[model samples]
Target: MPDADRALPAHPFDDDKLHEECGIFGVVGVQDAANFVALGLHALQHRGQEAGGIVSYDPDVGFNSARRFGYVRDNFTKASLMDSLPGQLAIGHVRYSTSGSKGQTAIRDVQPLFAEFSVGGCAIAHNGNLTNADSLKQELIERGSIFQSSSDTECIIHLMARSIQNNISERIKDALRRVEGAFSVVAMTRSKLIGVRDPRGVRPLMLGKLGDGWVLSSETCALDIIGAEFVREIEPGEMVICTAQGVESFHPFHPIKPRFCIFEYVYFSRPDSVIGGHSVYETRRRIGVELAKENPVEADLVCPVPDSGTPAAIGYSQESGIPYAMGIIRNQYMGRTFIEPTEQIRNMGVRLKLNVNRALIKGKRVILVDDSVVRGTTSRKIKDMILDAGAREVHFRIASPPTMWPCFYGVDTPEKDKLLASTMTEDEMRAHLGVDSLKFVSLDGLYRACGQKGGRDSADPQFCDACFSGDYPVKPTDMIDKGFKVKEPA
Candidate 1:
């Protein structure tokens, strides 16, 4: 279904295929809520690693929406832009392209899509994908409903439109009953902020309180931005309504075991962000400790690449008796310029996202811990930068095992052919990354790091592990880009 849109360029790097699923946040009952929502969206930028948006409600003007189809800070930080947007209630979304939702003009596609229904103007922002979107859309389209965006969120809006109810909560529940997939939704009516997660709790939505107002978000990290104290996570398949009446919650989906996407703890969420009830920092630290025990590396300093790698580096340092130090400093101002137009610009790799600290790395044997390698491009560039910075040796260490297959369930690891580990031998990978030596933690090490991988974690173990094990949750007949479909025709 998405083939025409994903017609990639002939050049490998020119093809911008790898994508990310992202973060969403909503707040009701707070004055100056737009500004606070802006701050909250900033913290959850890691969840989406792509675009951001926030839409708010005004008693006088009705609804106002402003979105930056890139990072929140860079996109939403204009003095004039902030003053123009005024509201007391708001909903926000940051997106990664995990669900193959990208189109010809994604900037135009950026959302918190605003729609008008008979009841009034209601808007919705969504995180997570719907496995049943196409079918649902087909059903809706056949019923004469029109769609403005290709995103599955439209179906929810359409469903709500068909329902006959004055109360937004009742309409949302009626709509929620028709869908079955991993969806964490936050919808805003003229004056109400509503939150819902699918019954199985396939995704996450948490509730927090800031002063007397109520906040709903995909991660607790967002709440921290607005000084909102965590009240509780929105229960699986539960609907939470936040208005002047406080909150009214409901459950509408069939119950199933929670499969909270362990990868969220591993690499998806920011370390400071908690998933379900687990600490991302603590989880990565455990990974590092396990890696040290299973694949001990002899290095002078355990250093991280900054941001995502810090937690694992700390764990590795504690587990291996290696001192953890800041060997690399990030160029927070730089756009992960990996998206630049040419290889000439892209070649200046680590300098784009980060820069090495010469004082820390010069003449030192450095163990560089990172999350995972996809195209082998970023890893290679980082290694070269460390060497250029004068590290005596750059030993590469990955916290997660190699991503050998593609992920279909919400991450954009679409095909195995482009994956580094899927095709190359480990030695080949080391050579590609241009490291002095390289070692990945064993699969066992990675799992043990997860605190009983076989036990009850919020996410299921039979994850769309196609990215690592090459065994998809629901295997395809062949990789013909059926658009996340379970099997090709026999």
Candidate 2:
């Protein structure tokens, strides 16, 4: 079998956390736009690490694309590859495969999924999941559309191809109107760089300006990577077409209240990025403060799980007046694709990626702050590591509420039954993990951390908290059709 057909081994540590499906970046009116796109994708690599691709449009070369399985820095950084993708307009994607074949991600599934239409050739990089994709795919297939990739993103391209609309932009608007769910798309034609967000805005898309060029990215941090100025967020239900002259904004879909993913602040986005004018790092820190206020405990030191949990740990330490220490040190060089070929290495699990600070943790009542607990396996292992390091007691404080539901909006999540919180109460989880105590910030507290002072609007939420509250803004049509049960409303 080819490399694409072979199932890639899942990193033991990576299986425990939720993953964003992909990140998208596009640039127009710049020399070698693919280079800027490469930088942007590198900045957003945390969103997706499985595969990456870039599609560039040059007047001479027409449309050129390169898709590969692995990190952006590993592939896109090659001078030869960058040279082949030269263009004034380019769009790119870093994919984690939430909507397609899971472990066996084929190169064809790697996006900036390009398709030639009657009007023109367009390549699109999508950063969210389409809830109605399966049903739409079936419908299209019955109508004689041959599928190339199993990816849900292909549904959009086919939808666009079948449209009677005269222009690519109009076809896109028409196609999106028939689809349901979250999307922040960066698409490109020969002359135009297009950006769009779903009606509910369950994903993030930002517009930036670099000299005379225009940039669209999944996060503001990608803009910063290319020295682009933060222009603004592409509003929910809006689309913008960019050219050398200027940008044109349109609300192609019916208006709906925006429900941007709340988890982005908690774990998905880079710490340095800003969302809706709030710094992601600040929001995470505030979440820590809320966690401390709601679940105060006596401990000698507050220690973060490392990386994602650091900001929240700081806030928790500050709020509780406890000394903060780096009880766990992460292996900076470890990549998610590191293969564990032996049973011994597989059993080592998180130890491959993280190590305990023996001296700091020795005899200390350590309060460990983390973003969230999914399967609880990682938490149990970490607790054992802390105990082995001579810690007197181990306590877990989660910045977000228990993730009881699986996300359908472009996040890779375990089935609901597999989630630790879905089947067990807090006390049961604490006992199961062998931790002295366990607590998660309440959903309302999470809202407060996101700057919603009055807490979540029960009647109509301000953000998407589907994983916590089991209230989905857009009905997960594909899953529903597959007989997946959604939580009943209270």
Candidate 3:
């Protein structure tokens, strides 16, 4: 377990935002495909840091695979490893645990989960969670399917294995039909690479092209890493199969109104990447502008919590006419505090990661802008740190609406009962954090920032705002059937 490598930090203030589930990358018709996959996975390392795996197919050797528990750079970047995985076709995955799963330390659970069928062999890598996996797994096991890994992704393989369809594409379609919730899947056969986005497009998958080759990745940044030209985003409810003969498209699922995850702009994606034809950085800046319009605060300066909050803080500063300052300096070497083990280590983790700039903040009324506050622990700790540094007043401006509901798609959010906003009012949250004021961007403002002209259209929502709004696009079948209650929105 990752917790065994280092003590899992027990601090309340550790990691108050949602965590993306995993990243997927695949390429076909590229010489030294594994190397390109390594670079692509490196670019996507931020999406998943716990483990990475790559599966490649060379006609001579058939299929080759390497799965390890650690950062992609530490595992996939070595020359020897890449050489061993040489092929014209490849797929890779970097993973954190699937949402709601725990104590999963087995490397077998890592991805590019492979299987051999009587028809032909293939490898699959998936981002996002399956809401109906448990029910499917139970049925499959009852029918005598021996499971290899505990990951929900393996359920796809099992379903594919039992599929009556002869063609690989048909089998994949059949498997997907049995599952529910968000998925952006990349798969490989010896002669082809395939990418599929679920009906609602709750997760992101983009198509790129390089020298007669096709690439598919969870983010556009991966395409940028390999000098691949952006082809287009794979459409919701769409599947693209790339082969030497060229590409073929299919829409096997019944169409629904697309609802891409809105939080991708609020946090998940790389700033440089484009989603829905808009730059993520620009979207975040626009979010800041919306927050400023919705909840303006008077203060001497606007400051960010660092890295994640930087762009929004700049936007807030510009719109609110508050000077933007880096009142805290981050220690680049320190890892995230959420992974720290003991409370003592957790308490020290923040100090080790960030230092207050006492001179700049002293006696200044500071406005701190951040993406969102889940548990409020991190916000409280930072508030104390700033006050101790002599800030006269602290106000918080959040770029997203209160994360009152837990995300069941792919993000690792706390259970609804544990989310601070789920249980507290704005006044209670401000008092708890010891801040003069706390304001979150309204849901409509967030939608407008995403380029929705008249704010959110409830009848045909533009994106998935389940974390902020109680309207989940897809029913969380497994969670609901298992008796896990979703708290009613306050």
Which pairs clash inside model 2? Answer: none
Count steric clashes of candidate 3: 5
> Highest lDDT: which candidate?
2
Candidate 3 ranges beyond 4 A from true positions = 1-14, 335-344, 486-490
Candidate 1 residue lDDT tens string, 1-490: 3533232222233122334466778888888788888888888776664566788888887788886655687767777777666778988888765543442325435668778877788878887766667777888999999887667777888899999988667888898887755678888998899898876565678899989899988788888877899999888778888986699877766776555565676677767777656687898998888778877867899998677778999999998998999998986655543443477765554465578888878899999988777777777777878888888888888887787766645566646768888789989998887787777776656666666655332244523344565443433322333554333233
Worst 10 residues of 3 by lDDT: 5-14
Ranking by TM-score: 2, 3, 1
Relative to the true structure, how large is the alpha-carbon lDDT of every model? 0.73, 0.92, 0.87
lDDT of 3 by residue, 204-293 (tens): 999999898999999999999999999999999999999856889999999999999999999899999999999999999998998998
Best candidate, TM-score-wise?
A: 2
TM-score of each model, in listed order: 0.85, 0.99, 0.95
- lDDT string for model 2 (347-432, tens) is 78889899999999999999999999999988999999999999999999999999999999999999999999999999999999
